[model samples]
Target chain A: MSGPKPNELIEKIDYNPPQKGWMDVPVKIRKGMYCYASNPKSVEYVHLPHARPWNPLEEDWKLPDNWKEIVHNAFRERLDRFRSFKVFMDICVRCGACADKCHFFIGTGDPKNMPVLRAELLRSVYRNDFTTAGKILGKVAGARELTLDVLKEWWYYFFQCTECRRCSVFCPYGIDTAEITIMAREIFNLLGLNIDWIATPVANCYRTGNHLGIQPHAFKEMIEFFVDDIEEKTGVKVEPSFNKKGADILFVTPSGDVFADPGTYTAMGYLMLFHYLKEQGLNVTWSTYASEGGNFGFFTSHEMMKRLNSKMYAEAKRLGVKWILGGECGHMWRVINQYMDTMNGPADFLEEPISPITGTKFTNAKSTKMVHLSEFTADLIYHNKLKLDKSRNDNLIVTYHDSCNPARGMGLFDEPRYVINSVCNHFHDMPRNTIREQTFCCGSGSGLNAGEDTELRLCGGLPRANAVKHVHEKFGVNMLATICAIDRAALPPLMDYWVPGVGVTGLTEMVANALIMPGEAERTTNLRGEPLPGMEE
Target chain B: MRLDELLTQKKTAIIDKWFDVVADTYPADTAGFIKRQKDPFANPVGGTTQKSLTVLMDELLGEMNHDKIDSFLDPIIRIRAVQDFTPSRAISFVFSLKKIIRNQLNKSDFNDHRILAELFEFDLKIDLIGLTAFDIYMKCREKIYQIKANEEKNRTFSAFERAGLIKELPGSGPELA
Candidate 1:
């Protein structure tokens, strides 16, 4: 009775210099007297003239009432089905540690984007739906009804989250708000409330078994296209590992790497690396099926997760490959390291991976026995199997930006870096928390692969770019290297935004470039110097 | 295959039938009695033909020493007190009142008919407004009903976890991670 009213508990005790007097003023009084009545969207409208992929409607497209009921019930069922991990993380203590940790919050100074508050919006609902206090006192107890408005708010903000799980690593309770964010998105998605940027790919993946929605013919065409690109760029007569059965390794990478940006270069690198391995009599078979590995739907729902992941296993079974290898994608590995075993199977199709040359068993496997390509390459280097020139990478100052999935999600902090340092002599680290488990995002992860919302992307990318910028300012880290495909897809555009001259490259790309050609001397030019196509000159 | 049609077809019918049965059994005259009882100018029950509640209200009034009902005894509280003081008799009274109100409700056909039914059944011990306790109670009741209606949802996630859709993080617990 004596304390601040229940509604006032979340009141801004901390305020800016001008608002000290207003902190204690009840929200009712503030609203009544025309206080901070400015619209939030006005800032975006005014500041971001070029923000493409604009949302024209506040409300999502609705289905018929009967259809709406079905959708709502389906979502409710999914909500009901959430595991302990879902419940545990949704009950986060509103600690501000994650607030400052978020790049979007730090860059834009928008309190709504702060990971802690972003989490609280949904956490309040969980408390209301599941807790005793919530049952006894409504909003006063920080429990609000699940109105259409709240769901819409969740759709907007949670999608903005990127499921980076960067906040989760720092949380005292280890609350991964990313999990809740994904769940919220999944619920919205069940109702067919989809945005074009992320959802189109998801629907594509569902329909065509790949996010790019490449037809089976187009998928094969992409491989051939990349092979030709490799021939043109590196003068290597590269061949795709297409439909080859019973090979020692079946390599798979993010399809984006095959189709776009620096990922295309990584795709080229994989081709060259496997070509090198092929010349060495390594009996490896690799092919791209509809990319079921890094399904954006994994970020949405279990149904989608099942639909997406089932393809890779199903494909692997069809091809009768001995082992499957995941390419450099962040969340794909997060799924592989964290969810794959639980999501899909005994994986009878996937044989335990072994070194093609050494025949040594890959004994220490993560949740799913599938090996991250970086981990495999790192192991190859550790065994002193890779013949390389460290000086070939000397032209560029290299720094490692650890992909979250491989580093924190899969506890693969050292392997990729070890491989990088082994292959390249000038390996450096970005500022603290820029590598390993504490890495920042490329801003376009978790299916935020949209051309619109570039402002939001830049805002999220600021923290990461700022870190890379510090290295560029001090040690002159000219080329940023990472292992995940999403990072490869995301970081290049971000580098262009903040530090104009700096570039991003995948670790495999660098390794492939430095790789000693079977017959020719490895002629590494300004290896990190020449601007790759699509990169700023 | 459409989940809404399945749930609505089954759950909605069950809820409607239950509502009708409960509505038919609730009292109609209680609201009129409460209205008439609260007026100070009306004759106080005394001497020969006093009903039990009339005597009780008289004593309660004497205790409060007021000609008119106190503002502290708002409509909800007064109604609750009257109902509480006449527990055995109140059940019969409420049923009679429900019978009278059913025809009117049918003619009106409001979407919030369920709200009225719930409000009518609310216990005297419940303080509905102190902190939106009424809404909270309703939500809790709804959640419980939801769990009952779709029992599979409550267990599927855990089963999936065991099935390996989500790998539990290290160190939380068998359930939490």
Candidate 2:
């Protein structure tokens, strides 16, 4: 029963890995660090290839006999298809500027999680197959053959990236590492190596028009349930229209806000806001067919992204809405801003988004004709359209977490803050480095927020939670507000782990808490039924 | 001088060495990065380790308030708990403080009998801290499992409600079934 000697203990705990070249180091797939393999049914549902049962932990991945040929052909096809992919694959000088910028690398301390190394995992393969020197000189030329182990390494590391593009911000060449991850994921999908978290949602979204697969009646019922709750809470009954034609705006949000906790509260917030606007003669309709704003297809493949994203413009045309208003979600906006117009546009059928409340033209969204909810709300607040009593949110010392897609992908920094500052009395920003374009990931973006990978999520969330912890200690900040539904679903558990006592909410939820409707009840509790600041007695 | 007085004089050095020992538990490349980068937000693992070790050392020498000691040990142990370390290796940093203290004491002439007694008492405190760290580490691991279980339950709960199996909505009392 005796323990080892002190020196023996120290010797046994040697975590300093031996000095080996990066190529020689083997990939170690640890439990709790990786996700379970995609369900084959989900893969086959989407008609993706190689839809056989395979586990990442096992040695035999059951890859096709010509898996190498499949990858090589797909890599070449993508190289021809995307000029950005070609440039990104050819460009990285490995100056190590993006090495420490990745939250996974900073939190987990895994060299492979470093954006440079994560891209190198794929870049080395690209060089091996495409470049002459890599083919001739081999390992000496910083390239290696694409063996089964190398493919396994690619699968393990590429999924580790959230595709937040924080590394691209620091790279001198502005090389987007996320595009490399997207390409790797595209290749992964071809081999049916998609994680269940992404593949199942993609399949569900393809079939049911939402990731949760909520049928039309069930989707309506969920909103009606929220409507009932809103009526009880505010004594103001709000009517929500579904699939109605000729509405001015078609509202779409991630189904997570309808099905998930805290996100359900955000959905209620949207209901209240829309109800108040309806009284003011603003007409908006929710669509059961294009019910989801968040796109899991973006995490699956480019073609799948387009396939799922096509629903928005198709529904907008069917409903004949002037423009679309997106709900709070992360990668959904990335797809809309970067790829939606190119892949699914010209969206010429829809009119440009002009705020009826303020008559301000959203010329920024002239191409895609979709306006973000923050921009829409901020414009409404600027024109004093809605009466807001900020004291309702006096219980909260709020800080905004810039969801990576809207912040980095869309440069949506000020609009959400402008809305929060208008809605809440006490607002503080986390360390200047951790907000806006430089904001940290909630560690669950790009469909990495599966339950089994809780350790990975918590570790990736460390830097973000650390920043929140600093502000919590300094300003007693209690609520972490965000505009993304994934952030709404993810940040609660992240805060529960890293910095307890802090809560998560969406900006719209805060606005709904502060919105002073015409004939509403005297509010005692906020949206979550927690007592307000002075109502705790 | 007495052992406590001598330890007080070398407190800063001890804490610095202790932080290095914890950092060494990571891979060499990560260890170097954590040691070199001093920014708390940029390098949270390094910052949390250094900050906790400083407070932990003071608590170990001073009144050893249980709450203060637990608070300081919580952050470091919580991090290491999730990291790729064996359970023994996760709490091993606690025992390394003994080696660091011994190395510091060996350099100074502390052969007096009273100093030896104080050293024995201090070692007991180190053992207590190690046990506390084990508890904290287990707590973090349990919390992670609980979070995972709750996540699965939350998803299922929504699905059940959507399927009309659960009659009661959330915020109402428990389901009758």
Candidate 3:
């Protein structure tokens, strides 16, 4: 009846889509547009509430007859549980400040990716069920019954959000979209409508102690593989501790660091750093039981997050370590900084994390007693404790990508850069808006990193990739150093596809490359085994 | 008689019109953002437009070589391949050139046999370039799917490995052994 068909050629776009009625707009679930249903094994492993076979693209989702009431009850329960969820639901004035702030919206031009609109997808549901005005006036009041289509829309858009909280920074009221997104996902979990990428990991981390489901032996062997590769690259053999009792510190990192490419190199960075610390007689132990740092359960629900988060403190107390040092990760930092203490914390058993070498107490991390790897490195550099050779990175003109979790969630902007600048001489910033607090997500954050939904991930990653492309062309920056493990795993392919020739690494990888370690071989290549430019054997 | 002359002479007008079509692909506010954008970082979708349009205009004027056309077409097409645009919508900008050329040429100009023959040749080249863009667009979509497939394999890699589905080199982890 109106303009072009959604599939037709470009015409004028209505940016201000009518606020009150999204039900009038049909859901566009195209081929290659949605992910497969959760594997029953993954769902059952977690013993999630509602367990039934369903597919997103199928005509019949086989929803329980009371699915609508289930959603309403779950929403009311969440609203009662979290005040922030209630506030986020109640307060959006719909001022479009966050309209263009999302990487997904910028990349794909999807109106639903707009943070405000994405929130409104759920907010509309809130009005339909609980609000009195919504009950009285249907579509006019922006309230529609919780139909199957509406539930599907919630799953599509809510999963699309990385829960990056970039919109929260720009919101005038400080209404976090991540709050609503987490709550929505929690409600989805209540119905057993889980995605495989999330559910499998949740089950894996629950049972085997890591998301990758690497058994204890395999987890140890994976690191040993990295240890061998590290020795091949640097000629420095390392014997990292595993589940050691009475160690001074407990070293924890995302298992992605142990399992994947590029991330393995960052894991090598941690090994070499820990090896150096070990030679200085500092005892740091790695635990297979608390193997994961990046929390997939955080993507699922708060209770699941608490269940997963309890491992770190439990393992720390069991091992009798004084403190914990978290390696490069994004969401892990957000969980550690914002939620870890309140959820399963109060680590009174452990002392405040003081750098054994630097003798500098991490006064800022006083409560949780967890220090970031970059902060520890920065302190060591500030005291000139490590012999750093910035010239080792002469071939690389690097730029720092502040991963969203650490940037906005934890305010960890300078520590990683301080470490990068100390080791790498040539470094540049992407742009003011796209860095630090305004950092874009890797698009594959949370559990959306699964291969089945790769296009969506790439769409969300466009803004970050575009920003990297700008610096690569303008500043001749060929290296992207980040503090997040997911960025290390995700940004390599992102850089390869969007802006070729740009390499990605953790800050510590660059540090290890620049480190003039004692009894190490002449450096000819970076940790990835690529021949370092300007240096010939 | 020179058909390319009509397009070359009206290059600015043609490009200005083509710019409108490309601009319409984005939201109106985004279109405004593109118009005002000088920094490529701030507005990359807007930034790549002028350089690409200029090359297409030059290709129409001179020899319409695939390599020449490809140099400009690949970047924009690859970008749009991952964008919200469908395959047809993403490459529709190529055919829009025909409209501009057809509008600029008068009826009297087409009546001359030489001009008509040249016009026929020019139309063929545009058609050829459209075909070329279609290939690039499909290849890009394939690449996106390829990446997705690779990632999917990786997601349950350990599961597969544990299930004895993935073959290993046997000596892959000699150090661990």
Kindly list the per-residue Cα lDDT of model 3 for residues A481-501, writing each as its tens digit: 988888887887687678889
Interface RMSD of 3: 4.1
lDDT tens per residue, model 1, A15-38: 111232211211111110111111
Query: Which 10 consecutive positions of candidate 3 chain B have the poorest summed lDDT?
Result: B168-177
CA-lDDT, candidates in order? 0.56, 0.89, 0.81
Candidate 1: list runs displaced more than 4 Å: A1-80, A89-91, A128-132, A232-235, A521-537, B1-177
User: Recovered native contacts in candidate 3, as a fraction?
Assistant: 0.32
Scored against the true structure, residue B168 in model 1 reaches a CA lDDT of: 45
Ranking by TM-score: 2, 3, 1
Error of model 1, residue A452, in angstroms: 1.0
State interface RMSD in Å for all models.
Answer: 29.8, 1.2, 4.1
Give Cα distance to truth, residue A91, candidate 3, Å.
Answer: 2.3
Fraction of native contacts under 8 Å reproduced by each candidate: 0.00, 0.70, 0.32
| TM-score: model 3 vs. ground truth | 0.90
Model 1 has fnat of: 0.00
For candidate 1, what is the TM-score?
A: 0.64
